[model samples]
Target: MTSRDTVTDPLPSGRGAALPDGGGVPASPPIPPRLLTDLIDSAVRDHGERRAIDFLGRRWTYAEIGALVDRAAAGLQAMGVGPDVRFGLCLPNTPYFVILYFAALRCGATIVNFNPLYVEHELRHQIRDSGTTVMAVIDVASIHAKVAAVAEESGLEKIIVCPLADILPTFTSLLYRLFKRSEIARWPADARHMAFGDLTRANPASFKPVAVTPDDVAVLQYTGGTTGVPKGAMLTHANLTANSHQMTLHVGHGAEANDRIMGVLPMFHVFALTTVLNFSVDTAAEMILLPRFELKQFLKTVKRTRPTKLLAVPTMLTALNKAAASQDVHFDDLDFVVSGGAPLPFDVRQEFERVTGARVVEGYGLSETSPILTCNPITGVVKDNSAGPPFPGTTLEIRSLDDPHRIMPQGERGEVCARGPQVMKGYWNKPEETEKVFVDGAIRTGDVGYLDEDGYLFLVDRIKDVIICGGYNVYPRVIEEALYEHPAILEAVVIGVKDDYRGQAPKAFVVLRPGQSASTAEIAEFLKTRLSKIELPREIEIRQSLPKTLIGKLSKKELVAEEAKKAAG
Candidate 1:
């Protein structure tokens, strides 16, 4: 789409500009009424021979990707998977994940993303909640065991397994087998269920795409569920497509089709799902995929790929800076770093700029809004700590957290509310919860932030006690409940502590039952099966008593303050 077609005008302060036309003022491509099938087909026809995805020394061109997607779609069609069916994707970051995601979309199916690290209980909860009947997972023995344990209980009828080296080079496959197998377990025996190779080989490389509308459900994204249970936020094709367009306009001046983007962020998260996956697809840019973020591996990948732009959370940036400082490494080719998903600490942003010699810009959004609302401008002027101005065709307002109807004045901290095309339709199957967040057509992000006089957004704190550790959201209550399940633990309060690389790590203060004893390592290991890696506490403090409020309720705020004081000393 042409720059003029995408935006009405630049921001009033001239901090933001319209998305630049690639070569000239070409006519804007019409936004598809439906997503998934239409976008993939069109990209394949237009950029068929171009490389679309790069991973572990292997690449997949658009034409090759299209063929694989077609076969997968046909295979799914044969399995009676179509509209209204929920398909769970439990694989890591790989080309197969991308292909299956689009293929399922082609058949008018809803994708339910599951973290690969989830155990049996966590897997069962999501599967039963989403009513997922089929799952596409990696051929890892531990993961397969977990899936098997939950399949019957959750009513999962079929399991499709893909190998890690399905697309990797022969030598790399050997290397992985010799070294990485113990870390990422291999499951040759589980290949008996449904081989991805057989599915792709047996099906034809062609399938009819399903017709859908803007309102049709595309993705059922589940949140951290800090309150009670994890719930899916129902996002339509229009919601995602509109957000992509809005973000494209917000940061399009310097980004080009030829620019290389690092896709280190997990695609399962909403921020990366839209920015790294869909945005890269829209711009026809090549993406360098990292399966998981390991400091050494990530640095090596960055040095090899030399990506010009990066979309990462604050934790990733912190890690990059620490690695560079401790190892004396350098990153001279990076152009810009975009931080989101959690509030970016001022210190991390400053250190990243000093180490990488690139601007680290911050943005803000929620899963309910296709995950992007504001971003620092790529041209004119930039703001260091603020999530620079709202994207085109978007409006932002701060309202009291207790009273959503009252709009707070500028520079005053309150709940951030957003209104734009990117806003989701509602939460999946929860009308009461949906009504609570959607007020006057604006999505109420439980995050508390304020807008300055110039319209730049500055986050203050989260209304919910959602702890962000290494870029993953850890609900304090979830961890506390898990600890409470232990017989030795009487009461527990979880809080975040500053860390050099992980941004924040969970620290639990526990009041054990009288005369009961447990080591920190013991408690951590006990909760490992119940919680994800990121949610586990780095340290546990056994306390004789926990501070309580006037009404005898646990006070986590006081604990956080005490920890901050200790750090300062």
Candidate 2:
């Protein structure tokens, strides 16, 4: 199959307005009902000799990765991981993660992503919640201990330990294992635990792919629940496949086949999973993986690889801008950069583009909508501060917060709702909660945003993140944006805290730029002219750094929890 053969334009022009180029949003043709694993198979067939992944100094060709995937799939089958079985993947962005992820899907098992940093308590909740019996985890000491604890608490039957050195060359693996022996977790010599190397040695390459339909569950992506217990969003094969097509349509051939795409963000994130892993595989692009984001190391890799596309978060961009301000960091080779996970500050975007000469555009998505709903067109006009237009087949409407059924007028701030082929089936095992979010056919994205006349979408803030000060709704994002305008402020997050009179009030946590200093009163004084009294943060706390989610979005939840704990104390 050719590059264009995997997807096509199926919708008519009437679905949306025309673009600046006198064309409607590129419509994705009916995505063929195919398993997510098919992307890897196609990549191997088309670019087998090309390097599929680059990790550390090691490079794995598409053909080599495909063989490993087959071996891992067969090994999983021998271990009883078949269709309908929940296979949990708790590894980070490593070669093991790539191989096992596809291998598990090839076995028709639902992939459940877990943050490797989670403690025992957190692991138990997710393990029990997803009913994952078999899990693949990194063989580091800290993570392994937590997984073992979860296994002891839950009915975790099999644990496949993927060592950091397992995938390295023989000499390097031996050196790494010897030097890093203290960091490696040796799970008690037992039958319940198996090394990834031993598992692959089974080499069941003859195992056949399981037959599955479009509706079959592909992954159970868990969301950071604000209202109640964390629930998994059930994304089907159809949902992910359509999103791959939608993104391709939105970007419009900017991502060429065999282009080097940077994978700095964790693949476990839905945003990175779609954009970095699945999308690159579908397009037969070479993916350069960074186990985690380290500004210095990332720049070094970029200089070496000369990646064409970067799928990054706002925080990474902010860091890059700061680094570039001090000295030259080559980024001119980057064809395009898509920033998601959080809102990209206007200043950061400007500086990044000025230094790197790469077009930086923002996109919006949630785990439930198979992640991507809107992205500024790569080949077309990008409006300032807008997340751009809806993906080809997606229909986005701004609805009244009071009544989700009441659709608001264009350019109105309200709850952003979306309906499309990419939307998930529902929240896993939570029919009632799913009913609450899905009104009619649209998924009520708890976010507050407006759509322009030309169909570009601009986000304001999340409804849950809104601060109520003296009976008035205050959006923290508005205050945060003002704080970002301050030259000294490097990172800022606003959260609602308990108040004696107002019931709740907004408080800002800020991180200053290196060698920069600012007093809380000075910040408040600066913002006084920019914001109304009630909208301004009542309290500002200066810190060395602010908390971040696994994907690096500012974690207002952690700040809120910290405030709550302080109040309790």
Candidate 3:
């Protein structure tokens, strides 16, 4: 593989063998063809009548979902949406999202995901930057106003409104309209505002299929833009389809077409977009969709649905574990759990597994890689403090921080680099930024980690996140892991704070477990044996809860900003 090659090479045979430390299961099964739209048609052909989406007690079979997708695709095509036209999707995890996602792909249009919670300015900037043509927004009052206000300025040609209860059964829809109507966002009355129902009901037949190839851009996934203005990561059809195949090869073992997977994370996030939604469509498994995470509602849904598998994050797992202590939550039916989007603490992993009686394995990835790069094998041994091995057909290396061009030997901590069929074509329209991150056909994951002799990877911290206290590198994760070991600590994060002598020192934020308490001195004393002297936090702050990212991962960035504001005040 090289930077000059536009398409990633296909995986070779014997590439899926079990890793040495955990003993490989078997060579990866033959990979299916690389086409994103094919997943929908194949699932319908194989298991047409099986449940495809279970939302708020409303269920839609695969046959029904496929029919809706075809109708939506036909309707989108009729509305002048064609190949390469940028389509904006701004909705939560509902049946509307699933239908519109596959429908856009089926129509050969590039899908651009938007966080439904974005304000007017944020939405305007993304729409103007991505050059979106048709925007699909949720029928909420605030969201509709924001989109409508910026439509002309952003050069949006058309707008579609999807109701939260569009796909619900008639009775359920009536109930939602009656009781939840006030809470639901109201739709706009503009001539340009058309309902999702109108789109599907008006066109009940399939449209002509366009000639889309693997090289065509499928998605314009935007980065968080922590460094600067957000840039869209251009993921081609081959990149998404190949990454989906690689994920299935690693985690799809024994997942039958009839199995059910929980879709709790918002679909707008790339982690859920690829792993949960795309993976379920690839495996023909039913997805239990929850628009948002509510503690009581999540527990009830789990009891009623008994999903076979769940794709989760560390914060979600910690919340579930906390809920299990006081509430009678049922997780015994779950086969396994896959956690990603952030590092999974060893204590959180152990507590979650013990309560649910299921293996909780952590995976690592970024949005630019179509989201999956490495994962702990479900059927193999899960190494402690490691994110397991690289996915089958994926290549990983640790490079020096000072000189990224130089690859470091195993066991040496450095920047984690990955090259695979999953890496994005490049950052959309940012050639210089893309060139900086991608070299020799590999994507530099800003994360810092090292590989053991047996090829298992152990994460240290992000390159930008490493705190230099008194000239000694202090990795926050090591301290956070030690905090989790304490019975009273439920969640923790460490960030560097300015100091008079040490230049910058570590500050700990602790969230105590329910009904338990621990002082800052007690926490520091407990970590004395685990972390070196310089790695210890200079100050500890106790709070009810720490801030989290949109996907619920503990966000050190938010904590750092909050601390900075407090210092200024």
Candidate 4:
């Protein structure tokens, strides 16, 4: 598909405008909109000198950012990255990440965003599964080891290593490397891959934008599979662009183009991708980047940046509130705290507002929906625990799990399904899995929720065993597989347990091998480097045996039920 296919004239002012067809204007399309690339181009042309991203201590203007993105696109073209090529981006929330992301899109390549915390095995699996030919990674030692392990095996021909402080001056780079060695050790080595800086500096700051259609796959966000493997959700340009516009409209007058946004969430996650990165770019707002969320650093950044908008999960909000209470940090500048990636407990929301003086607005979506389906209206009266109302032009219906075709009436909880342009095209190369979720024309959100008389959504439970901690989705199967890696662990089952802060935290029930022994702390420490903090279990329970289904398969549902009963008693 060509750029001509994606770019359409703005629609007339109306409730919902029709989207253009694949090549020309359609009779009636869902919300007519510009492509994501067009939005960036306009930002660059209008806000060329405006601050686009602030990282560490350096700031990048829109002109500088656009030039860098173009150079990166040129470099990728030089490396044979073009239409349909899947390029892996493994950097954190930094200017390099934004550059590479838009650059790949500009080249019409599908971006495969990889979690930087993935172990070598997980990284290898994603690289192989996505069939990525090029990977742009942070320049850290651990990442180097993982990339080296799978570079040749996965058919990855090129690796681009970006320094954590490359945009900073020479002295700052030296100090950053010396002071941040422990955390930065995960970056790849200098010799293993081309440096992002050198490549961009050498390349010309001009490249032809590839013709892309709205239906062209822009990003392939991978999610944990029910079959014990991960698959990429094919989110097309139309999917992402439409979702961003939907969110922008839903936010209403709360956020303006001049408002600065705190981007503490990882760009790899779809929540941050749409709300923080894409939304900020579309509005021509400055994004204050935090590579990772550390309480002290996070507080310091917020204090320094004084951002007007904040997007985060319940766990991050809980931690920030605790830190604010102790440190006396001022959050009067924050306009709204947008929460997602998990359910927001009522108490947590209340406490956060009491402590920070900011209202928390909860939203809901999955990776397959370009991540934003329902959100709290910026000006509406909010229900205590609802995820607000559906965004403009989006339709939500809860259907019985057994009969997906039958939509349940309001106030009755069932599987939440959504229909909109933001819905993904399909799962990459997984036709059966794609068919199972995409029924009729709507996407089945595997989450169970219901709508009230006021059209507000209240989430009851997740149909899938996915644990969300600190706004990141943590699959129980992934954690259980990690537990099995320990020689002492004979069998293990992981489940999400209620937490005062994080909504739900992972808890592992383990059975030791005959005569083998290991403590909870030991297992926790063992998995620390292998998984991100959100994926780690809060507690580990040594079990003589785990309850199983009638077929004898280890059942997490039974374990959750027993835990619930124990807690009630």
Return the top candidate by lDDT.
2
In Å, residue 322's CA in model 4 sits off its true spot by: 1.5
User: Superposing all C-alpha atoms, what RMSD in Å does each candidate have to the true structure?
Assistant: 5.8, 11.1, 11.4, 4.9
Clashing residue pairs found in predicted model 3:
18-24, 140-185, 141-185, 141-186
Better of 1 and 3 by TM-score: 1
The models' CA-based lDDT, in order, is: 0.76, 0.80, 0.78, 0.78
Give the TM-scores of the predictions, in the order they appear.
0.90, 0.79, 0.78, 0.89
Q: Per-residue lDDT tens digits of candidate 1, residues 398-455?
A: 8877787678877888888776556666778887887777655567777788888787
User: Which one wins on TM-score?
Assistant: 1
Model 1 lowest lDDT segment of ten: 18-27
Stretches of candidate 1 off by over 4 Å are: 1-34, 178-192, 225-228, 253-256, 326-332
On residues 225-307, what C-alpha lDDT tens digit does candidate 2 reach at each position? 33535689998887787788777766676235558889988888788899888888888788899888888889898888899
Candidate 2, after superposition: displacement of residue 536 in Å?
24
Query: 291-389 in candidate 4: lDDT tens per residue?
Result: 888888888888888898899888887787677666876687988888998778787788888887887888888888888888886676878888888
Mark the regions of model 2 whose C-alpha exceeds 4 Å error after superposition.
Answer: 1-28, 169-175, 225-228, 254-256, 466-569
Instruction: Give the residue spans of candidate 3 off by over 4 A.
Output: 1-33, 169-171, 185-189, 204-206, 225-228, 252-257, 465-569
lDDT of 3 at 292: 83
Number of colliding residue pairs in each model = 1, 3, 4, 14
In terms of lDDT, model 1 sits at: 0.76
Between candidates 2 and 4, the TM-score winner: 4
lDDT of 3 by residue, 26-66 (tens): 22334433668888888898889888999988899889999
